[model samples]
Target: MLRQGVSTRPARAGQACRGRPVPFSGSRLRSSTACGAAEVAEAPAAAPAAPQGLGDLPNVVSVLRARGLVQEITAAEELEAAAGAGRLSVYCGFDPTADSLHLGNLLGIVVLAWFQRCGHEPVALLGGATGRVGDPSGRSTERPVLSEEQIEGNVSAIGALLRSVLLRNSPPGAPPVRVLNNLDWFGPMSFLAFLREVGKFARVGTMMAKDSVRTRMESEQGISFTEFTYQLLQGYDFVHLCREHGVRVQIGGSDQWGNITAGTDLIRRLLGGEGKEPPACYGLTFPLLVDSEGRKFGKSVGGAIWLSAERLSPYKFYQYLFQVTDADVIKLLKMLTFLPLSEVDALQAAMGQPGYVPNTAQRRLAEEVTRFVHGEEGLAQAIKATEALKPGAATQLDAATLETVAGDAPSAALPRAAVEGALLADVMATVKLQPSKSAARKLIKGGGVYLNNAKVGEELYKLAPADLIDGRMLLLAAGKKNKMLIRIQD
Candidate 1:
């Protein structure tokens, strides 16, 4: 089943720095080494001032509204006043259906980062308990249940990813982010006690009216009792956080409006008391990340645009942003990057001006976002790999660089004997670069074939030991776009 809102699929641990805390300033990002622990550094001596026009917005809510990050918010004025008055602890939930989060889940992290930048405590709640029941918000069928082992493993991996991304680059004196598992609270609760303390407050008629429940009930597949009660489980999470952790705000995607409100309502009923004042809790939602064509933003032809470098390399991730349409790039820069709105406006204005270079905005968007997700070192590697792998570019190709590029490209492995002195056409066909040997030769004769980004003029050329970069890998290109990496084994 397709998990929506807070739920994410399992992802493996990628090449992310483990255990080390990297400092983040609101105005600028720091660099981190690839795969190794990054050293903690002092905040910059003179950080850039807040972007122009941000001065007019007094609180994080206004900042979010200005950046198109706010879709729906509860008690906007009161929340604004509270945020401006003092730091409020805010939380967003993530269900560990997968090991790594994809592009779809990014806005939540971005929103949390915005809160951090605005001087509020950000809490990331892992749905270790909720993942079992699954969120029914965007589903048409019941979710396949995961074993406890799968759930626990996912929680650990996602928690690591969360810490790596969220804890890094925090503003000075910002509260360190707290990653909590719902299971910590839910695991020990008795079923009868839950029904008495939490379930009693939820009205079944009101619950059935939720879009998630209503939609499922209308479907031929229909909703199950377990899935129907998911909102109550989620709503109680907010109550638990509020009473125990001082968390006062909950945020999520627009699809999660019901779940978010459920939590708010639960807080009001269970904790607000019979007083004239409003409950000290709120819910906010952001528009789902999508393109001009209305297609979801994070998916590619290959698969979900994963946040983990192990699932997808920084180069591939960078390329994805670099290729976004002109229609979408500017908006993305505003929503995804911490770049000043003034700079974003400048980029948007440049898009229609004369003498404008193609993809300048896209390149900047790619670099900024790559750095945010992968760090400075990851961005540098992406750039170097991008430049080195450009078709027919003069940059030298080395085995290390080619291996980085190979992470996102089609590749095959063959014995060193099979590749040495082998006919180029046969090798190309062997790697499935072409439909067959005849097709490979035909492409070669037409001057569309390349070896390590160089044009190949001979249809009968043979692979040589020297052709292998660092004596291990070779890059073959069928024209500019279709490329393959062949690794030789002894």
Candidate 2:
């Protein structure tokens, strides 16, 4: 069996909240309360709760609860109004800086898919233009600038993956998924025109006040002006969407709260400034997926566990889910899988019961998620690989399958003569199992090393040809992060 490793990345940061100006910005658009009491006093009081039809919208709280991620809704009344309006236009963005979305991005994509299913028009925004100016929300350092050609390639690849995933999960006759590149608008956008129109209202101090910006300033790596203006650029995107597509809601990760709100505020200000009836817009942020250990979801030492098959193989993806802890499994099932409530609850309870390991639940979770993204064929491969590795399962697997799995893993080759009558330390050393002789001895004494899928003991089990399941191969595992395929050639 392949030993799996635990992975972690940084936790996603702050989300936008209502009535509070973003945590970092200065008084940009003077609020009535802070700007002028007379003007504020004369303005209309906060509107009363409007009637809501959100229950009629697709997936609602049930999906949110299933994912175990908090849906930080703007307001009940706001959601109701949008639902009643028939086809609430909403947009979510994916930066094309990366060729593929990772598991962390899956939640956002699923949310958009569900929104479309619920009768809201969904817009997939490819941050072609904004991506040129990196978003600083989650970054500790500035991203290296990409060439124009690289950016275009990333956008194309990302779009293909986005279309594939959304089409797989989306129901028939759901709002048609529209793909947009911000570059279309921004490419032709002139600096003078932008300054005269969009930039006038977005004050520098107000922009700097965001937690994303504040965090950047305090960080040793420092922030760039391009990254700082990312929110404003995002705000302008909302205005563009509002005017062009009637999109009124922007949904994103909680770290995107500042940007989402900027878009909403832009809509309000732009329309009001021009003496037009202000178009209504709403913002919603979903909580970032974090494990029980409090680390951000996605990433192992091998690097990001990507959705793209090219980046992360289906077998590896299945193994990632299989390694989930009991505490995180149910939460993941809810967030990542479409398993029904009754079934999920039963599985959760079973996992908690004495002597019940979470393997079955994890496998089911992995299967559902893998199938949803990669389809039946993908799941079949995962199952096949799993069966090939499980104890007592080797005989059922063919030589080709064994070779395929072994070939995919990091490998070592040894002469048949060298393995015979060798100390376990020497065996470990020959295969580069440990970096040094001392470490190899420690591993042998601690019984942390395995030979041919079984734990090695006595530190001196001499290798024999009979121990090779296929008369050629040996599987060695070091802790959970390392797997070495060894072949004894004649």
Best of the candidates, TM-score: 1
State the lDDT of candidate 1 residue by residue for 1-490, as single tens digits: 1111112111211222232223223312112123322222222224443332234335899889989999988888988877776666699999988888998898999999898778676888889878878999988899988887888788888888888788665665554577777765565556676787888899999999999999999999999898899999899999877655567899999999999999999988887667744347889999999999999989988999999888888989999999999999988998999899999999999989999999999999999888888888889888989987776766688886787787677889999999999999999888889989999999999999989888999989998999998999888889988888889899
Please identify model 1 stretches exceeding 4 Å from their true place: 1-58, 274-279, 407-412, 421-451, 454-466, 477-482
Residue-wise lDDT of candidate 2 within 314-426, one digit each (tens)?
77788888888878888888877767678999998887689886488988889988887777877787778776566434324444455647635678888878765566677
Q: Which stretches of candidate 2 lie over 4 Å from their true place?
A: 1-62, 273-275, 354-357, 394-404, 407-410, 413-490
Candidate 2 lands at a TM-score of 0.72
User: Candidate 1, residue 134: CA error in Å?
Assistant: 0.9
**lDDT value for candidate 1?**
0.81
Against the reference, the lDDT scores of all candidates come to 0.81, 0.70
- TM-score for model 1? 0.81
The positional error of residue 398 in candidate 1, measured at the CA in angstroms, is 3.5
The positional error of residue 251 in candidate 1, measured at the CA in angstroms, is: 0.5
